[model samples]
Target: MPFTPFHMGAGLAAKALAGRHFSVLTFGIAQLAMDIEPLVGMLRDAPVLHGPTHTYLGAVPIACVTAALAPWLCRPLLRRWNQEVRHYRMPWLQESERWSPQVVLASALAGTFSHVLLDSVMHLDIRPWAPWSDTNGLYATISLSALHLLCMAGMAGGALGWVALQWLRSRRAAQRQRHNP
Candidate 1:
Protein backbone atom coordinates (compact mmCIF):
# COMPACT_ATOMS: atom_id res chain seq x y z
CA MET A 1 0.00 0.00 0.00
CA PRO A 2 2.94 2.29 -0.49
CA PHE A 3 1.85 5.69 -1.78
CA THR A 4 -1.71 4.45 -1.99
CA PRO A 5 -4.62 6.83 -1.75
CA PHE A 6 -6.59 4.20 0.13
CA HIS A 7 -4.79 5.18 3.33
CA MET A 8 -6.39 8.60 3.04
CA GLY A 9 -9.85 7.14 3.54
CA ALA A 10 -9.16 6.81 7.26
CA GLY A 11 -7.88 10.36 7.40
CA LEU A 12 -10.98 11.62 5.67
CA ALA A 13 -13.15 9.74 8.11
CA ALA A 14 -11.24 11.18 11.03
CA LYS A 15 -11.59 14.67 9.61
CA ALA A 16 -15.33 14.23 9.26
CA LEU A 17 -15.75 12.88 12.75
CA ALA A 18 -13.30 15.10 14.61
CA GLY A 19 -14.01 18.23 12.61
CA ARG A 20 -11.78 21.07 13.88
CA HIS A 21 -9.96 18.73 16.22
CA PHE A 22 -8.23 16.87 13.40
CA SER A 23 -5.90 18.20 10.72
CA VAL A 24 -6.47 16.30 7.47
CA LEU A 25 -3.46 17.90 5.86
CA THR A 26 -1.19 16.75 8.65
CA PHE A 27 -2.68 13.30 8.47
CA GLY A 28 -1.87 13.17 4.77
CA ILE A 29 1.72 14.15 5.45
CA ALA A 30 2.02 11.44 8.07
CA GLN A 31 0.66 8.86 5.67
CA LEU A 32 3.33 9.81 3.17
CA ALA A 33 5.96 9.74 5.89
CA MET A 34 4.95 6.21 6.88
CA ASP A 35 5.53 5.02 3.32
CA ILE A 36 9.02 6.43 2.90
CA GLU A 37 10.72 3.23 4.05
CA PRO A 38 8.73 1.14 1.60
CA LEU A 39 9.46 3.65 -1.16
CA VAL A 40 13.15 3.35 -0.46
CA GLY A 41 12.92 -0.42 -0.51
CA MET A 42 11.12 -0.33 -3.84
CA LEU A 43 13.72 2.01 -5.30
CA ARG A 44 16.51 -0.33 -4.22
CA ASP A 45 14.53 -3.45 -5.09
CA ALA A 46 14.99 -4.76 -1.59
CA PRO A 47 13.49 -8.11 -0.66
CA VAL A 48 11.54 -6.73 2.28
CA LEU A 49 9.12 -4.03 1.36
CA HIS A 50 7.79 -3.34 4.87
CA GLY A 51 10.56 -2.92 7.39
CA PRO A 52 11.00 -1.15 10.73
CA THR A 53 8.97 1.84 9.62
CA HIS A 54 5.87 -0.31 9.10
CA THR A 55 5.60 -1.25 12.76
CA TYR A 56 3.77 0.34 15.68
CA LEU A 57 7.05 1.20 17.38
CA GLY A 58 8.34 2.75 14.18
CA ALA A 59 5.27 4.98 13.85
CA VAL A 60 6.01 7.05 16.98
CA PRO A 61 9.07 8.88 15.68
CA ILE A 62 7.55 9.36 12.25
CA ALA A 63 4.36 10.69 13.79
CA CYS A 64 6.26 13.09 16.04
CA VAL A 65 8.38 14.34 13.17
CA THR A 66 5.34 14.78 10.96
CA ALA A 67 3.50 16.66 13.72
CA ALA A 68 6.47 18.93 14.31
CA LEU A 69 6.85 19.83 10.64
CA ALA A 70 3.21 19.71 9.48
CA PRO A 71 2.31 23.27 10.64
CA TRP A 72 5.17 24.69 8.59
CA LEU A 73 4.44 22.52 5.57
CA CYS A 74 0.66 22.75 5.51
CA ARG A 75 0.14 26.46 6.27
CA PRO A 76 1.33 27.71 2.88
CA LEU A 77 -0.57 25.01 1.05
CA LEU A 78 -3.71 25.82 3.00
CA ARG A 79 -3.31 29.52 2.30
CA ARG A 80 -3.09 28.76 -1.39
CA TRP A 81 -6.16 26.54 -1.18
CA ASN A 82 -8.08 29.23 0.69
CA GLN A 83 -7.12 31.75 -1.96
CA GLU A 84 -8.51 29.49 -4.65
CA VAL A 85 -11.68 28.93 -2.68
CA ARG A 86 -12.12 32.68 -2.18
CA HIS A 87 -11.56 33.28 -5.86
CA TYR A 88 -14.22 30.72 -6.72
CA ARG A 89 -16.58 32.27 -4.14
CA MET A 90 -16.97 29.01 -2.27
CA PRO A 91 -18.52 30.37 0.89
CA TRP A 92 -18.89 26.90 2.33
CA LEU A 93 -15.10 26.69 2.42
CA GLN A 94 -14.43 30.19 3.67
CA GLU A 95 -13.86 29.20 7.28
CA SER A 96 -10.47 29.62 8.88
CA GLU A 97 -7.82 27.03 7.89
CA ARG A 98 -5.69 27.41 10.99
CA TRP A 99 -4.64 24.22 12.78
CA SER A 100 -3.51 24.14 16.39
CA PRO A 101 -0.50 22.19 17.67
CA GLN A 102 -2.68 19.67 19.50
CA VAL A 103 -4.71 18.95 16.37
CA VAL A 104 -1.55 18.52 14.31
CA LEU A 105 -0.08 16.05 16.77
CA ALA A 106 -3.28 14.07 17.10
CA SER A 107 -3.76 13.92 13.35
CA ALA A 108 -0.20 12.78 12.77
CA LEU A 109 -0.52 10.02 15.36
CA ALA A 110 -3.79 8.86 13.88
CA GLY A 111 -2.31 8.81 10.39
CA THR A 112 0.72 6.66 11.23
CA PHE A 113 -1.10 4.34 13.61
CA SER A 114 -3.92 3.77 11.16
CA HIS A 115 -1.44 3.10 8.38
CA VAL A 116 0.20 0.36 10.38
CA LEU A 117 -3.11 -1.16 11.46
CA LEU A 118 -4.46 -1.18 7.91
CA ASP A 119 -1.28 -2.59 6.42
CA SER A 120 -1.00 -5.18 9.13
CA VAL A 121 -4.17 -6.89 7.97
CA MET A 122 -3.05 -6.88 4.33
CA HIS A 123 0.70 -7.35 4.24
CA LEU A 124 2.65 -10.41 5.30
CA ASP A 125 5.84 -8.58 6.24
CA ILE A 126 4.30 -6.10 8.61
CA ARG A 127 5.56 -6.94 12.10
CA PRO A 128 3.49 -4.44 14.05
CA TRP A 129 4.96 -5.53 17.35
CA ALA A 130 8.54 -5.69 16.19
CA PRO A 131 11.65 -5.73 18.45
CA TRP A 132 9.51 -7.30 21.18
CA SER A 133 8.12 -9.77 18.66
CA ASP A 134 8.25 -10.41 14.92
CA THR A 135 4.91 -12.15 14.67
CA ASN A 136 2.49 -10.94 12.01
CA GLY A 137 -0.67 -12.17 13.68
CA LEU A 138 -2.81 -9.68 11.79
CA TYR A 139 -1.85 -10.75 8.30
CA ALA A 140 -4.83 -11.68 6.16
CA THR A 141 -7.38 -11.03 8.91
CA ILE A 142 -9.77 -10.25 6.08
CA SER A 143 -9.79 -10.80 2.33
CA LEU A 144 -8.00 -8.30 0.13
CA SER A 145 -11.23 -7.38 -1.62
CA ALA A 146 -12.89 -6.78 1.71
CA LEU A 147 -10.11 -4.48 2.82
CA HIS A 148 -10.32 -2.49 -0.39
CA LEU A 149 -14.07 -2.25 -0.13
CA LEU A 150 -13.85 -1.10 3.47
CA CYS A 151 -11.45 1.68 2.50
CA MET A 152 -13.70 2.76 -0.35
CA ALA A 153 -16.72 2.75 1.93
CA GLY A 154 -14.86 4.89 4.46
CA MET A 155 -13.92 7.35 1.72
CA ALA A 156 -17.47 7.63 0.49
CA GLY A 157 -19.05 7.91 3.91
CA GLY A 158 -16.52 10.40 5.20
CA ALA A 159 -16.80 12.61 2.12
CA LEU A 160 -20.58 12.67 2.31
CA GLY A 161 -20.50 13.40 6.03
CA TRP A 162 -18.09 16.29 5.64
CA VAL A 163 -20.17 17.78 2.85
CA ALA A 164 -23.32 17.46 4.89
CA LEU A 165 -21.69 19.16 7.85
CA GLN A 166 -20.53 22.04 5.71
CA TRP A 167 -23.99 22.45 4.22
CA LEU A 168 -25.57 22.55 7.66
CA ARG A 169 -23.08 25.11 8.86
CA SER A 170 -23.69 27.34 5.85
CA ARG A 171 -27.43 27.09 6.31
CA ARG A 172 -27.15 28.04 9.93
CA ALA A 173 -24.98 31.01 9.09
CA ALA A 174 -27.46 32.17 6.45
CA GLN A 175 -30.30 31.90 8.95
CA ARG A 176 -28.37 33.93 11.51
CA GLN A 177 -27.55 36.61 8.96
CA ARG A 178 -31.19 36.86 7.88
CA HIS A 179 -32.36 37.21 11.46
CA ASN A 180 -29.65 39.73 12.48
CA PRO A 181 -29.62 41.86 9.36
Candidate 2:
Protein backbone atom coordinates (compact mmCIF):
# COMPACT_ATOMS: atom_id res chain seq x y z
CA MET A 1 0.00 0.00 0.00
CA PRO A 2 2.37 2.66 1.24
CA PHE A 3 5.95 2.99 0.08
CA THR A 4 7.20 3.14 3.65
CA PRO A 5 5.76 -0.25 4.50
CA PHE A 6 7.09 -1.62 1.24
CA HIS A 7 10.58 -0.34 2.00
CA MET A 8 10.49 -1.50 5.58
CA GLY A 9 9.10 -4.92 4.79
CA ALA A 10 11.62 -5.46 2.04
CA GLY A 11 14.52 -4.14 4.07
CA LEU A 12 13.64 -6.11 7.15
CA ALA A 13 13.10 -9.20 5.08
CA ALA A 14 16.54 -8.86 3.51
CA LYS A 15 18.21 -8.29 6.86
CA ALA A 16 16.49 -11.29 8.31
CA LEU A 17 17.86 -13.39 5.47
CA ALA A 18 21.42 -12.10 5.97
CA GLY A 19 24.05 -12.77 3.35
CA ARG A 20 26.01 -10.98 0.62
CA HIS A 21 22.76 -9.40 -0.60
CA PHE A 22 22.28 -7.30 2.54
CA SER A 23 20.65 -4.38 0.72
CA VAL A 24 20.05 -5.92 -2.67
CA LEU A 25 17.95 -8.92 -1.65
CA THR A 26 16.33 -7.53 1.43
CA PHE A 27 15.35 -4.20 -0.11
CA GLY A 28 15.63 -4.93 -3.79
CA ILE A 29 13.33 -7.96 -4.06
CA ALA A 30 10.71 -6.39 -1.86
CA GLN A 31 10.73 -3.28 -4.02
CA LEU A 32 10.83 -5.41 -7.14
CA ALA A 33 7.76 -7.33 -6.02
CA MET A 34 5.86 -4.10 -5.54
CA ASP A 35 7.01 -2.93 -8.93
CA ILE A 36 5.85 -6.14 -10.59
CA GLU A 37 2.51 -5.64 -12.38
CA PRO A 38 0.71 -8.85 -11.45
CA LEU A 39 1.38 -8.37 -7.76
CA VAL A 40 0.69 -4.67 -8.16
CA GLY A 41 -2.54 -5.39 -9.98
CA MET A 42 -3.80 -7.00 -6.80
CA LEU A 43 -3.16 -3.74 -4.99
CA ARG A 44 -4.60 -1.44 -7.66
CA ASP A 45 -8.06 -3.02 -7.78
CA ALA A 46 -8.75 -3.77 -4.11
CA PRO A 47 -11.23 -6.56 -4.89
CA VAL A 48 -13.01 -7.22 -1.56
CA LEU A 49 -12.65 -8.77 1.93
CA HIS A 50 -9.00 -7.77 1.61
CA GLY A 51 -8.62 -8.97 -1.97
CA PRO A 52 -6.23 -11.58 -3.38
CA THR A 53 -3.19 -10.45 -1.49
CA HIS A 54 -4.99 -10.79 1.82
CA THR A 55 -6.03 -14.31 1.00
CA TYR A 56 -3.82 -17.23 1.95
CA LEU A 57 -4.19 -18.26 -1.63
CA GLY A 58 -2.13 -15.32 -2.72
CA ALA A 59 0.10 -14.06 0.11
CA VAL A 60 1.19 -17.34 1.67
CA PRO A 61 2.04 -18.91 -1.63
CA ILE A 62 3.97 -15.88 -2.72
CA ALA A 63 6.07 -15.85 0.42
CA CYS A 64 6.71 -19.54 0.17
CA VAL A 65 7.57 -19.44 -3.48
CA THR A 66 9.92 -16.53 -3.18
CA ALA A 67 11.76 -18.15 -0.32
CA ALA A 68 12.26 -21.23 -2.45
CA LEU A 69 13.52 -19.18 -5.36
CA ALA A 70 15.51 -16.26 -3.89
CA PRO A 71 18.79 -18.21 -3.85
CA TRP A 72 18.62 -19.42 -7.42
CA LEU A 73 17.74 -15.89 -8.35
CA CYS A 74 20.62 -14.38 -6.40
CA ARG A 75 23.39 -17.01 -6.17
CA PRO A 76 26.06 -15.97 -8.66
CA LEU A 77 25.99 -12.26 -7.99
CA LEU A 78 25.72 -12.93 -4.31
CA ARG A 79 28.79 -15.16 -4.45
CA ARG A 80 30.75 -12.44 -6.18
CA TRP A 81 29.61 -9.84 -3.69
CA ASN A 82 30.21 -12.11 -0.72
CA GLN A 83 33.80 -12.36 -1.85
CA GLU A 84 34.00 -8.58 -1.66
CA VAL A 85 31.86 -7.86 1.40
CA ARG A 86 35.02 -7.50 3.40
CA HIS A 87 35.93 -4.23 1.64
CA TYR A 88 32.70 -2.64 2.80
CA ARG A 89 32.40 -1.68 6.42
CA MET A 90 28.86 -0.49 6.37
CA PRO A 91 27.56 0.38 9.84
CA TRP A 92 24.58 -1.91 9.48
CA LEU A 93 26.51 -4.92 8.32
CA GLN A 94 28.67 -7.03 10.55
CA GLU A 95 31.24 -9.23 8.90
CA SER A 96 29.97 -12.77 8.63
CA GLU A 97 30.31 -15.76 6.37
CA ARG A 98 28.02 -16.07 3.38
CA TRP A 99 24.50 -16.99 4.46
CA SER A 100 23.13 -20.45 3.95
CA PRO A 101 20.42 -20.91 1.35
CA GLN A 102 17.92 -21.92 4.00
CA VAL A 103 18.51 -18.74 5.97
CA VAL A 104 18.09 -16.52 2.95
CA LEU A 105 14.93 -18.34 1.92
CA ALA A 106 13.37 -17.97 5.33
CA SER A 107 14.21 -14.31 5.40
CA ALA A 108 12.84 -13.71 1.91
CA LEU A 109 9.57 -15.39 2.86
CA ALA A 110 9.34 -13.31 5.96
CA GLY A 111 9.94 -10.18 3.94
CA THR A 112 7.22 -10.97 1.39
CA PHE A 113 4.69 -11.96 4.02
CA SER A 114 5.48 -8.91 6.07
CA HIS A 115 4.77 -6.64 3.14
CA VAL A 116 1.38 -8.22 2.41
CA LEU A 117 0.31 -8.33 6.02
CA LEU A 118 1.41 -4.77 6.70
CA ASP A 119 -0.27 -3.48 3.56
CA SER A 120 -3.52 -5.26 4.34
CA VAL A 121 -3.64 -3.52 7.66
CA MET A 122 -2.82 -0.09 6.23
CA HIS A 123 -5.21 -0.04 3.30
CA LEU A 124 -8.75 -0.66 4.47
CA ASP A 125 -9.76 -1.47 0.94
CA ILE A 126 -7.05 -4.12 0.75
CA ARG A 127 -9.02 -7.22 0.07
CA PRO A 128 -6.09 -9.62 0.29
CA TRP A 129 -8.54 -12.33 -0.63
CA ALA A 130 -10.00 -10.94 -3.79
CA PRO A 131 -12.35 -12.88 -6.16
CA TRP A 132 -14.10 -14.15 -3.05
CA SER A 133 -15.78 -10.77 -2.44
CA ASP A 134 -15.60 -7.02 -2.88
CA THR A 135 -15.63 -5.54 0.60
CA ASN A 136 -13.96 -2.46 -0.87
CA GLY A 137 -11.42 -0.44 1.15
CA LEU A 138 -10.38 -0.10 4.76
CA TYR A 139 -10.47 3.79 4.36
CA ALA A 140 -6.77 4.03 5.38
CA THR A 141 -5.40 6.16 8.21
CA ILE A 142 -5.66 9.30 6.07
CA SER A 143 -2.83 11.70 6.90
CA LEU A 144 -0.73 8.93 8.40
CA SER A 145 -0.82 6.84 5.23
CA ALA A 146 -0.06 9.86 3.12
CA LEU A 147 2.76 10.83 5.42
CA HIS A 148 4.11 7.30 5.45
CA LEU A 149 4.34 7.12 1.67
CA LEU A 150 5.71 10.63 1.37
CA CYS A 151 8.42 9.98 3.90
CA MET A 152 9.38 6.60 2.46
CA ALA A 153 9.52 7.92 -1.08
CA GLY A 154 11.61 10.83 0.07
CA MET A 155 13.97 8.61 2.02
CA ALA A 156 14.42 5.93 -0.62
CA GLY A 157 14.69 8.44 -3.41
CA GLY A 158 17.01 10.56 -1.35
CA ALA A 159 19.26 7.63 -0.58
CA LEU A 160 19.56 6.75 -4.26
CA GLY A 161 20.22 10.38 -5.15
CA TRP A 162 22.81 10.65 -2.43
CA VAL A 163 24.59 7.59 -3.78
CA ALA A 164 24.52 9.03 -7.29
CA LEU A 165 26.01 12.29 -6.04
CA GLN A 166 28.73 10.41 -4.20
CA TRP A 167 29.55 8.43 -7.32
CA LEU A 168 29.89 11.61 -9.35
CA ARG A 169 32.00 13.20 -6.70
CA SER A 170 34.24 10.17 -6.59
CA ARG A 171 34.60 10.13 -10.34
CA ARG A 172 35.63 13.77 -10.45
CA ALA A 173 37.98 13.28 -7.54
CA ALA A 174 39.58 10.33 -9.33
CA GLN A 175 40.01 12.36 -12.51
CA ARG A 176 41.54 15.26 -10.63
CA GLN A 177 43.90 12.90 -8.83
CA ARG A 178 44.94 11.35 -12.15
CA HIS A 179 45.62 14.76 -13.75
CA ASN A 180 47.45 16.17 -10.74
CA PRO A 181 49.31 13.03 -9.69
Candidate 3:
Protein backbone atom coordinates (compact mmCIF):
# COMPACT_ATOMS: atom_id res chain seq x y z
CA MET A 1 0.00 0.00 0.00
CA PRO A 2 2.17 2.80 -1.20
CA PHE A 3 1.23 6.24 0.15
CA THR A 4 -1.32 4.64 2.42
CA PRO A 5 -2.11 5.43 6.06
CA PHE A 6 -1.71 1.77 7.02
CA HIS A 7 1.97 2.36 7.63
CA MET A 8 1.16 5.34 9.84
CA GLY A 9 -0.94 3.24 12.19
CA ALA A 10 2.16 1.31 13.19
CA GLY A 11 4.11 4.54 13.56
CA LEU A 12 1.42 5.92 15.81
CA ALA A 13 1.56 2.81 17.98
CA ALA A 14 5.35 3.09 18.18
CA LYS A 15 5.04 6.69 19.31
CA ALA A 16 2.43 5.82 21.92
CA LEU A 17 4.24 2.76 23.27
CA ALA A 18 7.80 4.05 23.09
CA GLY A 19 7.00 7.66 24.00
CA ARG A 20 10.22 9.71 24.01
CA HIS A 21 12.16 6.76 22.61
CA PHE A 22 10.39 7.03 19.24
CA SER A 23 10.05 9.91 16.78
CA VAL A 24 6.88 9.82 14.70
CA LEU A 25 8.34 12.13 12.09
CA THR A 26 11.36 9.93 11.53
CA PHE A 27 9.12 6.92 11.30
CA GLY A 28 7.07 8.62 8.61
CA ILE A 29 10.19 9.47 6.68
CA ALA A 30 11.36 5.87 6.84
CA GLN A 31 7.98 4.68 5.66
CA LEU A 32 8.22 6.98 2.66
CA ALA A 33 11.75 5.78 2.05
CA MET A 34 10.54 2.19 1.97
CA ASP A 35 7.92 3.03 -0.65
CA ILE A 36 9.99 5.34 -2.81
CA GLU A 37 11.33 2.53 -4.97
CA PRO A 38 7.88 1.19 -5.75
CA LEU A 39 6.50 4.64 -6.32
CA VAL A 40 9.17 5.44 -8.89
CA GLY A 41 8.85 2.03 -10.48
CA MET A 42 5.12 2.50 -10.89
CA LEU A 43 5.59 5.91 -12.38
CA ARG A 44 8.16 4.67 -14.86
CA ASP A 45 6.40 1.35 -15.47
CA ALA A 46 9.45 -0.59 -14.45
CA PRO A 47 9.42 -4.39 -14.50
CA VAL A 48 10.40 -4.95 -10.87
CA LEU A 49 8.33 -2.74 -8.63
CA HIS A 50 9.30 -3.96 -5.17
CA GLY A 51 13.04 -3.98 -6.09
CA PRO A 52 15.89 -4.22 -3.53
CA THR A 53 14.63 -1.32 -1.47
CA HIS A 54 11.90 -3.53 -0.05
CA THR A 55 14.46 -5.99 1.23
CA TYR A 56 16.10 -6.15 4.65
CA LEU A 57 19.50 -5.47 3.10
CA GLY A 58 18.17 -2.23 1.64
CA ALA A 59 16.21 -1.14 4.73
CA VAL A 60 19.30 -0.82 6.95
CA PRO A 61 20.97 1.82 4.80
CA ILE A 62 17.70 3.56 4.04
CA ALA A 63 16.88 3.66 7.74
CA CYS A 64 20.28 5.12 8.50
CA VAL A 65 19.89 7.85 5.90
CA THR A 66 16.38 8.61 7.10
CA ALA A 67 17.58 8.69 10.70
CA ALA A 68 20.36 11.08 9.82
CA LEU A 69 18.29 13.51 7.74
CA ALA A 70 14.69 13.24 8.94
CA PRO A 71 15.17 14.99 12.28
CA TRP A 72 16.38 18.14 10.58
CA LEU A 73 13.19 18.26 8.52
CA CYS A 74 10.84 17.07 11.24
CA ARG A 75 12.10 19.09 14.19
CA PRO A 76 10.40 22.29 13.06
CA LEU A 77 7.08 20.53 12.49
CA LEU A 78 7.42 18.80 15.84
CA ARG A 79 8.11 22.11 17.53
CA ARG A 80 5.00 23.59 15.99
CA TRP A 81 2.86 20.62 16.97
CA ASN A 82 4.39 20.60 20.42
CA GLN A 83 3.28 24.16 20.85
CA GLU A 84 -0.24 23.31 19.75
CA VAL A 85 -0.63 20.17 21.82
CA ARG A 86 -0.83 22.05 25.11
CA HIS A 87 -2.82 19.34 26.85
CA TYR A 88 -0.25 16.76 25.89
CA ARG A 89 2.80 18.90 26.56
CA MET A 90 4.90 18.54 29.66
CA PRO A 91 5.48 21.76 31.57
CA TRP A 92 9.24 21.32 31.35
CA LEU A 93 9.07 20.68 27.58
CA GLN A 94 7.62 24.05 26.64
CA GLU A 95 9.54 24.93 23.44
CA SER A 96 12.52 22.89 24.56
CA GLU A 97 11.59 19.38 23.48
CA ARG A 98 13.40 18.24 20.36
CA TRP A 99 13.92 14.89 18.67
CA SER A 100 17.25 13.52 19.81
CA PRO A 101 19.55 11.59 17.46
CA GLN A 102 18.95 8.41 19.39
CA VAL A 103 15.19 8.77 19.10
CA VAL A 104 15.42 9.45 15.35
CA LEU A 105 17.61 6.42 14.68
CA ALA A 106 15.43 4.08 16.71
CA SER A 107 12.21 5.28 15.13
CA ALA A 108 13.58 5.17 11.58
CA LEU A 109 14.80 1.63 12.00
CA ALA A 110 11.49 0.59 13.50
CA GLY A 111 9.56 2.17 10.64
CA THR A 112 11.67 0.72 7.83
CA PHE A 113 11.74 -2.77 9.31
CA SER A 114 8.01 -2.74 9.95
CA HIS A 115 7.38 -1.52 6.40
CA VAL A 116 9.32 -4.50 5.06
CA LEU A 117 7.38 -6.90 7.26
CA LEU A 118 4.03 -5.45 6.31
CA ASP A 119 4.82 -5.46 2.61
CA SER A 120 6.30 -8.94 2.72
CA VAL A 121 2.94 -10.22 3.81
CA MET A 122 1.12 -8.70 0.85
CA HIS A 123 3.60 -8.60 -2.02
CA LEU A 124 4.73 -11.77 -3.68
CA ASP A 125 7.63 -9.91 -5.25
CA ILE A 126 9.14 -8.85 -1.94
CA ARG A 127 12.15 -11.03 -1.22
CA PRO A 128 12.94 -9.60 2.22
CA TRP A 129 16.26 -11.41 2.38
CA ALA A 130 16.93 -10.79 -1.35
CA PRO A 131 20.51 -11.48 -2.64
CA TRP A 132 20.66 -14.45 -0.25
CA SER A 133 17.33 -15.87 -1.50
CA ASP A 134 14.52 -14.82 -3.80
CA THR A 135 11.75 -16.71 -2.09
CA ASN A 136 8.78 -15.06 -0.40
CA GLY A 137 6.82 -17.63 1.56
CA LEU A 138 5.05 -14.94 3.56
CA TYR A 139 2.99 -13.68 0.69
CA ALA A 140 -0.72 -13.69 1.51
CA THR A 141 -0.21 -15.74 4.64
CA ILE A 142 -3.12 -13.79 6.13
CA SER A 143 -6.25 -12.20 4.71
CA LEU A 144 -6.13 -8.56 3.66
CA SER A 145 -8.98 -7.89 6.04
CA ALA A 146 -6.90 -9.20 8.93
CA LEU A 147 -3.95 -7.02 8.02
CA HIS A 148 -6.14 -3.91 7.69
CA LEU A 149 -7.80 -4.73 10.99
CA LEU A 150 -4.43 -5.00 12.68
CA CYS A 151 -3.46 -1.56 11.39
CA MET A 152 -6.74 -0.08 12.48
CA ALA A 153 -6.36 -1.66 15.91
CA GLY A 154 -2.95 -0.10 16.24
CA MET A 155 -4.36 3.32 15.41
CA ALA A 156 -7.18 2.97 17.97
CA GLY A 157 -4.96 1.56 20.71
CA GLY A 158 -2.24 4.14 20.12
CA ALA A 159 -4.70 7.01 20.18
CA LEU A 160 -6.21 5.76 23.44
CA GLY A 161 -2.83 5.24 25.07
CA TRP A 162 -1.58 8.68 24.01
CA VAL A 163 -4.68 10.39 25.35
CA ALA A 164 -4.45 8.46 28.60
CA LEU A 165 -0.83 9.33 29.15
CA GLN A 166 -1.45 13.01 28.48
CA TRP A 167 -4.44 13.06 30.80
CA LEU A 168 -2.44 11.47 33.61
CA ARG A 169 0.35 13.97 33.15
CA SER A 170 -2.07 16.87 33.20
CA ARG A 171 -3.74 15.51 36.29
CA ARG A 172 -0.41 15.19 38.05
CA ALA A 173 0.47 18.75 37.09
CA ALA A 174 -2.83 19.97 38.45
CA GLN A 175 -2.27 18.20 41.74
CA ARG A 176 1.24 19.60 42.06
CA GLN A 177 0.08 23.13 41.29
CA ARG A 178 -2.70 22.86 43.90
CA HIS A 179 -0.23 21.81 46.60
CA ASN A 180 2.47 24.29 45.64
CA PRO A 181 0.27 27.29 44.95
Question: Model 1: runs farther than 4 Å from truth?
Answer: none
Give Cα-based local distance difference scores for all models: 0.89, 0.51, 0.83
Off by over 4 Å in 2: 1-6, 13-31, 34-51, 54-56, 87-98, 121-124, 129-139, 142-181
What's the lDDT for residue 36 in model 1?
92
* Candidate 2 per-residue lDDT over residues 92-122, each given as its tens digit: 2222335566666555555555555555555
lDDT of the structure predicted as candidate 2: 0.51
| lDDT comparison, 2 vs 3, better candidate | 3
User: Which of 1 and 3 is ahead in lDDT?
Assistant: 1
TM-score of each: 0.94, 0.49, 0.88
lDDT value, candidate 1, whole model: 0.89
Across residues 62-178, which tens digit of lDDT does each residue of candidate 1 receive? 999999999888888888888988798876875456777888899999999999999999989899999899998989989988998898888888888877887788899999999
Per the 3 Å backbone cut-off, how many clashing residue pairs does candidate 3 have? 0
Deviation in Å, model 1, residue 13 alpha carbon: 0.8
All candidates in order of TM-score, best leading:
1, 3, 2
Each prediction's total of clashing residue pairs, residues at least 3 apart in sequence or on different chains, is 0, 21, 0
Give the top-scoring candidate (TM-score): 1
